[model samples]
Every structure is written in structure tokens, then in C-alpha cells.
Target: MRSHHSLTNKAWAEFHVDGLPHVHRVFPNGESTMAIVDGLVHGDYVAAAVNDTAVTLTLFSWPASSISRYCYAIHLQIGRVEGPTGRLAVCVQVTAAREVSPVEDYWCMTVDERVALFDRGNAHPVATFRLEYENQRTVELPK
Candidate 1:
């Protein structure tokens, strides 16, 4: 995944998985809310949604050589760092489907538990993004 922050303060992210590309833009809607817009690409699918607390971006792809499907998602939430002043930060969580499972079994798991499992090392290529708010939000991309 690659991201860009424009001069207009619009944050854009692009994900390339299994040779498919998906792009999305995230910007502040009001003082507390956020808005997202996605570009439509053929073959794969991307969905972006924002609520009162967070913005989530999910990517879905079908591999030609496998019967199993793959899903990758990122959730961004505003939070505060541990301190007396309690500086603002953005807490990001990334989750990817590990394997195919029966529909019944999948439905039994809650979203929180699944994310916990991924955090416990059940998923590969895990990452955390910490955007600190001083005068503006600044992101340090992984090198």
C-alpha cells in the first residue's frame, strides 16, 4: 500500500494486491467527521465507509488459481497518546483474511475477536500507522 497527502489536505491511499490496484481518498468532512471516495477499477473490488468514529477501507479480490477468496481491510480511528497532555493520534488496524472457512464458522466470529486474532500474529504483514496531530496531521510511512 502507498499513500499521498495532497496540498489540499486530502489523504489518498492505493493498494496493489495480486496485481490489482485500488485507490481511495480520505478527507475531513467537518471538525470530527471524515469522508472517503474511491476510484472504480475492473476485476477487483474496493469499498470505503466512514462513521462517527472511524474510516474503513476494504479490498476484495478473486485469485484465478485458487478457489479461496482474499480480503484486506484497514481501519483508522482517532485516539490520544498516553500522557498528561494526551496528544492526538490516529490508531490504525490492518487485517487480512488468513484462509477460507465454512460460511457457518465465519459467521460465528465477531469482528473484534477476528481483529484480535490478527493482532496476535494469525495474519501476515501487519502494520500500524500513527498520525500525530500538532498543527496538522503528519504520517510517517514505513520504509
Candidate 2:
């Protein structure tokens, strides 16, 4: 049998009030995709930290079979690192290409209908909400 994902909703949001890990989230498509309260990742990934927060997240994989090095860095400003004594590291190292892989396995999709991937620096939406609350729908790709 396949192992189920561990990032349930409660754990992701509350960060373990009972001194344990693993989150639980539910949605209409829980069987197809998990509920992501925020953010998403694609391809092989891992996020870790020594404190309740982290110093950084790095990627050092090849683009394919090439040997070119891509230099990238991530800096975080978190409130957990201020003054705490927790020894925990939550690592999610996974990758999937399916449209639902992130939504299902990683909970990458947003629950808020207003969140978007891109913006035009305007105070409006680039896409319209024509979705029906009664059915599953396919995403419309831009040409």
C-alpha cells in the first residue's frame, strides 16, 4: 500500500499544540488532492530547520542531465526563532508532475478563491470566477 501524506491541516496551521507532528486537512477532493491552506511546491523538494523556524531552503539539483550550476537562495524572517526551545525539523522531500499531485499530496492549492499565482500590480483580478460550486472542473490554460 502507498504511504499517505503527513501534512494534514491541523498540524500545518497549529504547528503541534500537543507536541507532535503531522497535519490533517479535508476538502471535497481529499481523495484526489489534499487541502493546502497556503503555498505549494513542485518537483523534488525539502524544507527543514533547526529551530521552530529555519535559516534557509536550498536546491542543488541538475536541470536534466546537464552539469550547469544554478545559484539560488531563500531567506526567511520568522517569529518562531525569536526565543524558543524546540528541537523539531519537518522535512517534506517530494516531487510530482500531475496537476493534482501538489494539491493532493502537498496541499499546494489555496482555499481562498482570491489567491493567484501572478498579478499585474493592479488592485483587481486577472482571472474571473466562473466556477460552479457544484462540480469538478478542468483548468483553462492560456494560449
Candidate 3:
């Protein structure tokens, strides 16, 4: 069986959480996608997903924090990548992508209903929500 660490590492794309002030994001490059939570660090409770072309990182929640009645803030990172020379960062809000369900851990959609990917100053959403949780969703992506 695959180790839990292995699974998490595969499902999450790693990125720093110091910048990207808004929320809801996507990234074409694997290493540039991460969500910034208000009171947490990288890998707190983040989700990772991908399509044919790009990857996305989303912040779900912290282990002890309550996201039930708040605005549900998130920090999304998105952009094109070119070597180590690309301006890859932006933030957007993640809202109830899905209706609030009886299962409290399910992922709600962003207010806009989608996470977007685009160049700096451009607005676009990239992926839809498929999971939610009362706690943070850790992520690990393929290297």
C-alpha cells in the first residue's frame, strides 16, 4: 500500500505562503501554486488538483480553526511559468463552490464558483471544487 505521506505528497503542489494576498488561484507550473491562509503556514490544509495543462492549490482550513460561518478566505497562486524568471502570483477568494452540505468537511465553492488561472492583472478561473472539509486538506503533487 502507498504510505500516507506518499499519498499526501502526490496530491499536493508545494509553494510558499508569504505572498499572493487574495485567494482562488491556479498555476501552470507545479512549483508556483499555493494557498495562503490567514493564520497558517504552507501545507496547513491545502488541496491540489489538475487538468490537462495546469495545476491548482487551494486552502481548505486549519485543524483547530472554525470556517463554518466566516467568509472562508483562501489564497490562490496562478500564472505562466518560465524558468525562474516569471512573475507568478495572484490571490482570489474561494467561496461555496457547492452548496453547504450536511457533511461539514466538504469543500464549498468560491463565491464566483471557480478557481482561476491567468497572467498577472488578468482575471480567470481554472478549476471547480470537488471536496470540502472542516479541517485543512493537505496536498502533495507529482515531482
The model with the greatest TM-score is 1
Cα-based TM-score, every candidate: 0.32, 0.19, 0.26
lDDT of 3: 0.35
User: Ten-residue segment with the worst summed lDDT in candidate 3?
Assistant: 111-120
Superposing all C-alpha atoms, what RMSD in Å does each candidate have to the true structure?
12.7, 19.0, 15.9
The alpha-carbon deviation from the true structure for residue 27 of candidate 3, after best TM-score superposition, in angstroms, is 26
| Ten-residue stretch with the least lDDT total in model 1 | 33-42
Clashing pairs counted in every model: 0, 6, 31
Measured on C-alpha atoms, candidate 2 has an lDDT of 0.26
How many backbone collisions does model 3 have? 31
Q: Mind giving the per-residue lDDT tens digits that candidate 1 earns over 1-143?
A: 33354424544433322222232334443221112223211122233334433334443322222344333445455545566654667767665554344232322344333333332244544577678765545799999
Q: Give the per-residue lDDT of model 2 (tens digit) for 1-143.
A: 12356444422222212322223223334332222222332122122454544432322111121232121112122223232443333232212121211122223333221122112132232222221122235799999
Q: Which regions of candidate 1 are displaced past 4 Å?
A: 1-68, 79-87, 99-125, 136-143
> Evaluated with lDDT, which candidate comes out highest?
1
Candidate 1, number of clashes: 0
Ranking 2 against 3 by lDDT, winner: 3
Q: lDDT score, residue 129, model 3?
A: 41
The TM-score of candidate 3 is 0.26
